[model samples]
Each structure stands twice: as structure tokens, then as C-alpha cells.
Target: MPAVTVSDITTLARIPEPAPSAAERGVRSVTEAPTGFEGEGFPVRRAFAGVSHTDLDPFIHLDQMGEVEYAPGEPKGTAWHPHRGFETVTYIIDGTFEHADSHGGGGTITDGDTQWMTAGGGILHIERPPEALVASGGLFHGLQLWVNLPRALKLAPPRYQDLRAAESALLSTPDGGVLLRVIAGEVAGHAGPGATHTPMAMVHATISPGAQLRLPWRRDFNALVYVLSGAGSVGAERRPVRTGQLAVFGPGDVVTVAGAEHQDARHPALDVVVLGGAPIREPIAWGGPFVMNTRAEVLAAFEDFQAGRFGQIPAERVPHGDLGELPTQPA
Candidate 1:
């Protein structure tokens, strides 16, 4: 591991949108919400749980995947899409996903599976909805986060890591009602999920209502939280933060969440992701499906993709994934 640096660990958290007050709020219910500007075909849904990308050092985008229900027996496909200078991490909470990439390696990711892919330099891929979801018209819920690459690895080769849910080590603390699932980096005295290519921390936490979570913070790293499901409040922000929204916190000693009571009896848990890391601290030149450091670099990437530098996809190629299918929904 490298020594920590002030420039690398300094993070600023702000409540971009303060959570709603459950006390003053009226009874309400919401199902599918989507984020991200309109993507290509299929009306890229911002359907409603939160979707936005604030500051995650070296990371740019975060989309709260949904229970995308497709027609019976007809698999939903996102044709091929391209990405550069970043890696994509897909964490499945339920359902199944099948991805294929231009990098030449891909497989099915069922419930409890995680796929970390590096689309260094450039790659094209497609992620198709699992047939099971189409067959049963059930729910497909998960998250896909785009982690930007430091300048050093911007042009590195593309790669992938498929770790199953059962294989991923977990740390569950009943005392505080905290469930920490480590996707990368160390948490709660546990280590060795194989180091993430980027120096980062990705943890999925299920905070029980009235439970509290206090995580150590090192200056220089940016921090943000995505409320996955249920309603809850955060530090300095006692309002309710439900699905489909993000809480950008202000810099401080630690992040605190209190005064959240589950709305449903069967589901008394509040789910969210605590992601923070040193930012790349570089310019973001983004266009369509590509992200790079400069406009010129962005142009070059499109040229490569258009010229077929990255191979083509199969007949029913979907364009909603990065480098093909590792964790992309390239629609």
C-alpha cells in the first residue's frame, strides 16, 4: 500500500439535497425510479430511486440499478457501448445478469455476484438482462458504479474480476445493527478480497432503523452516499433519505445516521452504500459513452470505437454496458 497524502485524502461532504422529514411528510410509496440523463434507446430511465454522481475520488458516475421488468420470456438487451479511462463495478442484490465484452471474457452474474472490470484504454461491450427475469417477470435490482482511473492506469489494459456473493467475505455486527459487505479494501478488521486496482473503499451497508454507523475518515478523499432502499437520515441531516437519492456530506470526523424508523414491518432495514476515496483530481472530458481527461482524448476514443479498434458485438448487440458486458447496461 502507498502512503496517504493530504492531496489524496481530503474530502468534502454536503447534503446536496437534504433528506425529507418523515414527521412532516405524508404517507407515500414509490417503485421504479431511474437516473442519469437520457441514454440511447429504451428511454434510459431515471424511473425514480436516486441516480447521480457527485465526488468519489477517481470515480465519476453512480446509478442505482432497478427492478427493470421486461416482457415475459423476452430478454432485455443493451447493445454494445464503449468506455475508457475507468473501471465499472457491478453489485447485484437480486436477479441475474449476463454480460459479454470486447475484451473477450464475460459470464453470468446471478444474485450475490460482483463484477469489477477495468476498461483501461478502451473497450466495447454489451450487458443483457437475464432470461430468468424475463421468464418470471420478477425484479432485477443492483448497482453499477463507474470508478475513474488515475492518470497512470488510464491507458492500461482492460481486465475483469468476477467474485460471487458467497465468496465475498462479510462483517455483520448485531450490536450496532450494522452489516458491512466488503467489495474491496479492508473493513471491520477483515482483509484480502484481493486489492482493488484503484486505491478505494466500496462497502454496502444495511443500517437497521435506529442503528448508528460511524466510519473513520482521512482527509483528501471525497465521500458520498447513495440511499438504495427505505427511508433514513444522515449526519447533520436528520431528514429522511429514501431510495433514488444521494447525500453529499460535509467534511468531518465521521458520518452519522440516526432517527430512522423502518416504514414496513417485513422490511425494517435501510440499505445504502458508503463510497469514498481519493479523487483523481483531473479534468473530466466526457462525451456520450466515453470519459477521458481531455476533449482531444475523448475524440481519439470515439475514433477508435467507430473505426472498430474494439471488436464488434454479436447479432443482438446491446449498447448499454462498458467494454461489452462486465457490468454495463449500455442501452
Candidate 2:
């Protein structure tokens, strides 16, 4: 939960309060994420599970990586994989992850850091914990979101962005009740560092117990609030929510969330990631790892990948067992 912090939150810029006349969004549905294992058997919560594609347009999938404390030799990550027609945003709240792609886009992202990769046309990449971390064993928690690209940009050149925690636009409420890290798009008048193909906003908020956070939201974007830790309520109706739950908000100009008066000792505050994006509204054909507008397109992507169109792994690229032996920090 130490993604970013300040000694005096009041010293940070404050998000302006929404006007009284502004319409407050209502909660459409609250769903709980199911626990599962991903990659090479690392536990994950399917954050977007059971949610309709229409409500998650522009967002294809989300996985809440372990909040678990790993013992020595227990750390795991994904093998080299191919992706196309989408972007993958990996934000680390704790621990470290090393990424290397066939297109020469790779880096190490730690607490509060982010690695954004646009697999516009196609790309091959792998993510795993560094050797030091695997040897020492430690806590690891993070989120990986799959953002769908519009049909027009499906074959665009790939790109990468490494966003450090310091680059996030940090803000607080007038009362210092919450700390918000804007990772992408605009919040109020402040913008995050991520450059996205689709119009979207991503914010990580830490709300003190008994505090309420109300955000001025774009009317055209669909809103969603996913709880990362602790207990809380969402929307103008104040529907009860807790860790591993996601609240989908209806159309409105303001989105509201409030922390419970009390929380479990393990999680002292309410932590949530708020996301919104302009709907793509186009047909979606998603297969394992690839997201395309049509099934035929998805099939073509698999064919191209099998035919070596995605490029080969670099010769110098170390295999998984050796990955930990590499430098933990990005050079």
C-alpha cells in the first residue's frame, strides 16, 4: 500500500469539490472478483470478471496480482507470450517486476512504478520477479490492466512508457482525507504521465477511515471503482463494498466513494483504483492474449505469431531461471 506517500498531505494540490448541481452517479452493480492463478502460477484476482463487455469497453481485462507474502523460491511470472490489438498497463504497488519484449521495450518497475506497453500491431514479452526478490522472499501486490485499442489503431506501431511513481500527479482533498495518484488521463485539471490510444483515466486513491471522496468525472466516460483493500461504500447510494469488489457507476458528472468508519487491522484505510474510458462501441473478438475486433482478426494474429511474424526473442535474452541473476534495477 506504500505506492506513494507524503509527510504532509495537506501540502499537496487539492482536487476541487464538485458543484452542488452536479449529478452524482448511481451504482449499477457491485461484483466480487474471484481468486485464481495466472502467469506461472502466481495468485491473482480476476478484477473484471462477470462484468459486461459493454460496461468495460476500452478495458478488456484486469488482474489484481497477489497481495501475498511469498516465501523463498515461490515467486512466479508469465512465460514469453504474444499480444496484439491492445495495450497492457502493469502498475506495481509493491515488490518488483522485470519486463522484456521482443521489440526492445523492457524495464524494471517497482513500488509505485508503471510499465505501459502498447501491443498495437503485435509484440512478444515476458514478466517475472527479479532474482534477488525471489531469493529473499517478500510481499508483492500489483495490478495489470488490458486496454483495448480501436480498430483504426489495431495495426499501429508498438510503443512503451515507463512511468515512475514520482511522475504521477498527486493530489488530496481539502481536508487531506485522501491521497490520489493520477496515473493516466486527466483528473480535474491535472494529467497523469501515461499516453493512451483510447481516451481514459486511471486513479489510485487511499481514503482515510470515515472519509468520503467525490470526483468530478467526464460525463461521456463510463466509470468504475475497484476496491483493492479495506472496506468502503460506493456511488451516491453508498452501497457497501469491500476488498476484491468492483462497483460500476451509471451516467453522471460526479462519482462518490466513502470509507467505512472501521476497518480490519490488516488494512487500515480504503484503497481503490478508479477507472473510466470513452466507450469504443465496436464489435469485440477477444481470444487468449489477443484482443481484436473480429474472430477472423484474432485467428490471423495467432497465425502470424506461429509463423514468426511477431519477431524472435533476443539472443541475449536470458531464460526464466537466469532472469533473477540479472540486475534487479533497470540500467
Candidate 3:
């Protein structure tokens, strides 16, 4: 799970310890993600499954993609689809993904890179592995998060931001026990490169064995911690959590997570993605690929899509698996 790493974590800027008066959040709930298939049959873990909508306000859905190694001709991705009324943030941790959309937002993102697509109003898009990757399969692991837009911004123009791994704000815990990659929003005095429509923070942290990470969190934003791999405990209560489990924290000004003393050989450290966002508190009427403030609006979105109002698919596309010759290894 090499998203981003440094030779010397101590050399990075350190996150300050929380103040004495800061309240430490308690673990509200811990739930395991259910495994499922997505796109064109690639494995995914529904990261936000079984989590309440109210607690997940501003953020609609999340999927931990892959973490699976594929053989040649086994790579897969989503077919052309349409989305509206939200933004999709795809973060690649260990593999490559090709994205193309009708709105001219497309790119190839790999190891630590991010593709932020605002599907406000409406747009057609597609996500797929490149032909080379399909021909010469390798490891693929990533996350795709759906962030909801407020009612006022539902019809905002579509936009895209390609955030490279180098642009991430890398930080370390005060004791240098953990490395944090801030993909979006601000942490302490440092901010990530992602510009979000909603006020939110996304951080991918790797905690060494027996290490702990304490973060000063926003009082207004809700907190959630999802373990990508290994074992850990969350919140001040130290609620035990493991791979594919999500821990939602209760109201507080600080968030805490600690890695267990032991881990399996496959995953030597604890990896987690911490997310928080200010509550939107608006009614959501989500259908298939559209998220709207009302049921009627969601119906209208489907009509528009069927009527060809979302724009047409591009003439050129990233091939799924039509390469003439298969490569012996990933390029």
C-alpha cells in the first residue's frame, strides 16, 4: 500500500499535539465493509456500507477498490456512465487507472495520484484500466469517494482537478510514528491540494507498529476512520478495529488512532484513511448515478440523461482490453 512515503519521516513537518483542553472523540461505531464487485466486475469493498446517512452527510459513498493482484487480461473497470449533483474523488494507492469524461476531464493516475471530478449539473464519464495494464496485469488498489454538493451548487459547472502525489501535503506525527498524506482539506496549518465543494478533510496515514497518531480535528466537521489494512484502535476509547472496518467518532476536537504491536507479514503497518466533512443536512434523493435534493429532481436528472442532455461520449476512448499484443509485464 505505497501511496506516498519518505526515507526519513522525522524530516517532515510534524502535526502538533492537541491542546490540553481539546476533547478526544469517542468511538461511536465500528462496522466492517462488505466485499462486492463494481465497474466491470473488479472487486471492491463498500467502505461506507451500513453507515447512517445522517452521520455521512456531505459525503455520499465510498469504495475501497481492489488491493488485488490481477493476471493478464484480468484488469477491469467501469463502463461509460453518467453522474450528477456531486463530485467523485479517486485516489490511486498502488496502481494505475485511466479516466475519461464527456466534459473533457480525463487523465491517467497512478501511485498516490488523484483525480477529482465535479459532476455537477450532469456529465458522462468512464473509468477503466489502460490497455497495457490489462495486457500485463499487476496490483491495483485505490479508493473512490462520492462527495455530495449542497443544494445551491447542484447545478454548478463541471470541473476537474488532477492532483499529483507530489502536491500532497505530507506530515508526520509529533513523535514521527506515523506518516500522513493530506489529499484534501487542511490539517493543523498544512493544507492538501484538492479543492472541494464541501468542507472536508481526507488523510491517508500509515502507522508503524505500536505507534499512535493524534490529530487536532475541526469541531464543526464530523470524523470517520476506515482501516485499509492491518490492525488498529480508534478514538480515545481505543476501540479495536481491523482491515475493512470503519470507525466513526463522536463529537470532539481531537481524533486518535494507534497501531497494534503485531501485524501480519503481508501488511507490516496499519493503514487508514481518515475523513471528515461539515454536515450538509439537506434532504438527499439519490438514484443510480445521480444525487439530488429531491425525488422529483432526481427523476428529472434521469430524463435529461435519457434525452442526451448530459453530453455524448468522446470519439476516442481508453481501450479496456483490445490491445493487439499482450505485454509480459506491466509497463
Candidate 4:
């Protein structure tokens, strides 16, 4: 993938997103992913449940992190951890997240920034709120998704990509009541900034009252939508979903998402993320932080971590950088 630079951002972002094609439409399924907490005390609502959902193959898990507002001087975050055989994609919406890994890769991703980390082979990393944020309380919200790697690439080298909000490709409805931001894959011929080993699309969209949007999709991909806030309807069946709900779509080449005609002013727009990927149909053995094709591979991952091959950061050295202190939102 080509690196995104300042000179080209405006032009790329201005490109119009593909409109939804008029074709046979069907509402495959609408189900809410269970919500719970993981990692220290942070709350997370899982969009995909269990080891795997056939409809959401290749994309193993999606965790909607706390949209919680922390009390002054009482912030909390994740501790050092190890992962292998897949990739971790973190997208922040409201707060700051400081990251550090064994490969000496570290950075801060605040509002609208995304951090995509491939934990191939193995890696020890930590993600937490910065000390400055903890000292002064604020809102913390984001989403962390786990994308399964094909068996052939599960043991590939680890890599990281941090994309700021401005680097993404953005498009809006003619009247600007709806906005679509593509972070990965292409929309309406406009390519996003993040490159993926697996073919996928990660789009964040916001629709205002009575607005409608139709985006073209790939027939081969298993698509799903998660309403981050407010309420909306989607597909030909016009399945309704509100905040914290996950809608898994059936096979289709075009997705239709529309906002409520009478939207609540407090939560005026329907905010959601559309995710889809080509399925990796191979058998998978999921064991906590590691995901592999075979039980033996899963054992090997744990052994390697125990043997210290994943590398480690001192527990005392928290927040690794002052990245959170930088502007929370991109210019």
C-alpha cells in the first residue's frame, strides 16, 4: 500500500464514495452481540461471540471498549500482554490510547486514530491511557477488533501501522447529512489508508435524521454492522438496530443504511462501523490470547510466551510516551 502524505489527503478524502447499487436486497439476520468486561476493569461489548461465527469468518472478535467517563484521577487501562497468530486493530473515538510493544514499536492514538498491529510469530505489548489523562479525568471510548490471519501467514513477522483521522478517505451525502469514512479497503474507488493481509473493509459512518446511504459491497465478503450510538435501520428488510447492537448481513453486493426519520436530538445521528472480510474457512483453535489452526500451534504459542520469546516491557514503565498529551483530535 502507498504511504499517505499530507499533499494527497485532501484530494483522496474528497473523492466520492460508491453509491449503493439497485439490486435484489435481503435482510440476512439481525442479532445483538453480548456485552461484558475484559482486560483489567474496562467494559467491552463483544460484537462476535464464541470461538467463531461462520457468518463472520476471518474476523474473529470485535470489542467495543468503554465509552465510560472516568472520575478525576481514577482512570484505568490494560496491562502488558502477549498475542500471536493474528492482528489487533484499535480505533479510538473519544480518548487517548498509548501503546508499546516488544519490537520497540510504540505510539499514541487518540480520537479518530487507528492502530493496526499484526501479532504474527509473537509479541508482547501494552495499551493504556496516558498518565496525563488519568491525572485529569476525561471520556474514554474505542473499539478493538481481532482479525484472524490465514494459516500460511500466522507465523509471519510482526508489524504495526498507525493511521490518524486525517489520513482516512472521507465522503458525505450531497447535503452533508451523512458521512462515510473509509479506513481500510476502497469505497467508490477511493482507497483507504490502512493495508490488510486479509481482504476487508472498515468504514465508520454517521447519518443524521431522515438521511439514507447505500454503499456497494463485495459479494464474497461476510458483512456486518455495529451501531456505535443512536438508532438506525438497514438492508431491504429495513432491520432496526440501536446503540450496542450488531447486525450481521446476508450475502449481498450492496448495503443500505438509513437513519431514523425522527431521530433523537441528543443522539441525532446514527453512528456505526461497517466491517466485512473474505472468510478463512480453515479450522481454528482459539485459546485465549492466541488463535491458531491446530491445538499444537496453540500450545507452542503459550510455550513461546512462557520462554520469554515474545519480549516484555517493565511493569513500572507505564504509558511509554507522552503521545496522549498531544491533541486528541487530528487537525
Per-residue CA lDDT of model 2 for 45-132, tens digit only, reads 9999999999988798999998989999999888788888999999999999999888899999999999999999888889999989
- Give RMSD (Å) of candidate 4 vs. truth: 7.0
Winner by TM-score between candidate 2 and candidate 1: 2
Q: Model 3 Cα displacement at 311 (Å)? A: 1.2
lDDT per residue, candidate 3, 119-172, as tens digits? 999988888889999999999999999999999999999998999999999999
Per-residue lDDT tens digits of candidate 1, residues 1-331?
0011123111312111122421221112223445543223222324224323344456777666664544577445565677788888877777677778877768888776888888898877667666566677655667778888877888899998887776655555435366656677655445426357777777777777777665554345555666776677766546457766566665554555543765466346677777767766777787766778888887787777767776666545433333432322221
Model 1 error, position 207 (Å): 1.5
Once superposed on the true structure, which residue ranges of model 3 sit more than 4 Å away at CA?
Answer: 318-331
For residue 44, what is the lDDT in candidate 2?
96
Pairs that collide in candidate 2 are: 131-324
Segments in model 2 whose C-alpha atoms lie over 4 Å from true places:
321-331
Q: How large is the C-alpha RMSD of every model relative to the true structure?
A: 9.9, 4.7, 5.5, 7.0
Comparison by TM-score, 3 against 4, better one = 3
Worst lDDT 10-window in candidate 1? 1-10
Return the TM-score for each candidate structure.
0.77, 0.96, 0.95, 0.88
Candidate 4 off by > 4 Å = 1-25, 50-52, 314-331
